[model samples]
Target: MAERQGIGEPRFERERQDDAQASISWLPRRLDADAAEPKLRRFGAERFEPARLSLWAMAIGRDPERPLAWLLAADHLPRALLIAGALDPRPRQDEEALVLDGGRQPTQAQFERWWLWERLARPKRWSLRVQPATLRAVALPLWLGYSRGRSGAGQERKTRLIVLSGLSGEALGALKPAVLAGLRERTKAQTDAFRSGVPEGTPEPG
Candidate 1:
């Protein structure tokens, strides 16, 4: 008998930094650091961290040439958010500094099953096909705010995270689960590598 493979296996590239940065599209950030700081302050966050999430875009329905596109979070836990129309991502400009990219790349099969079909319930009205060549990966900007607060007097203060959209500076409560899952996975990987001894060329965790 053959062994069974998990559907969520990390078969795709682990982290495509240089290649993705060069080729992949990026959603423009309308809120700069100066403008975002005040927004974070309102949430009582002492400091903020900038990050990026990799999203998968594909045209679904009967026509592969449809103008509208679907955007999938494509992280550890996939979430689907439908864009109104076609994807028109802007290139990262020179002034934009690099940020940590969270989320794993999903295989075409996994993307279709987990992110698309599962959510849409395999609508019979539309003819959906996964065209590997048509799949495009884009980066979405995010802001993570760190705030310290105490449950009650005499209790130790604990830090909390607030996620916001770097594009519109709006709170991203729905994406909290995906963000937390990605952070936990990254932490576990670093911890395991540390226990096994860090490699010479391996970069230190920031």
Candidate 2:
């Protein structure tokens, strides 16, 4: 188990400022921005921001028996399962953070397909009769570091986005594309909704 930071800490003040615009239900995060700052600095980011990514938790195994749990990213496209170990999720509100709800919730059928593919790679697990035992929404904490291009000082400094897992404090280079795609889609949906005078959180038109 990882150590969790209490909400009363002074470091939360900076996180609150960084994520003032977004909020959502989140799983209790073990790592805080302050604790992840030193690693984030290595990216040479001009500034670091805190954010959250929506994920779906599903238990897949024989019904009536305890099943293995998995976390799937809520991105528009299907992605490999995230490497999250045992989680003790609890509701903790009043924590301000930028929650990215840009991805679609993966359907049960999608999970089945992914499971089959995964099993094919592991022949020994083929006999395991698995199914989605339960499904629910959850959020993973993330840190976004914004760094400028290393071009000449006279040249414009284009900002680059670097993502890291707030849980293990590891850089998520492979998931960067998916994260960027989700952000773009979310921004587009919000813009479209605003233009049509629709309230925020309204489902985008099909």
Top candidate by lDDT: 1
lDDT of each: 0.64, 0.63
**Model 1 lDDT tens row, 97-196:** 4344445555566656644554466465245554444566677788888999767888888888888887778887767776777677668877887967
- The residue pairs that clash in candidate 2, if any, are none
67-88 per-residue lDDT for model 2 (tens digits): 5545454544455464434555
Candidate 2: lDDT over CA atoms? 0.63
* Clash count, one per candidate: 0, 0
Q: Using alpha carbons, what is the TM-score of model 2?
A: 0.65
Question: What is the alpha-carbon lDDT of model 1 when measured against the actual structure?
Answer: 0.64
Error of 1 at 174 (Å): 2.6
Q: By summed lDDT, which 10 consecutive residues of candidate 2 come out lowest?
A: 16-25
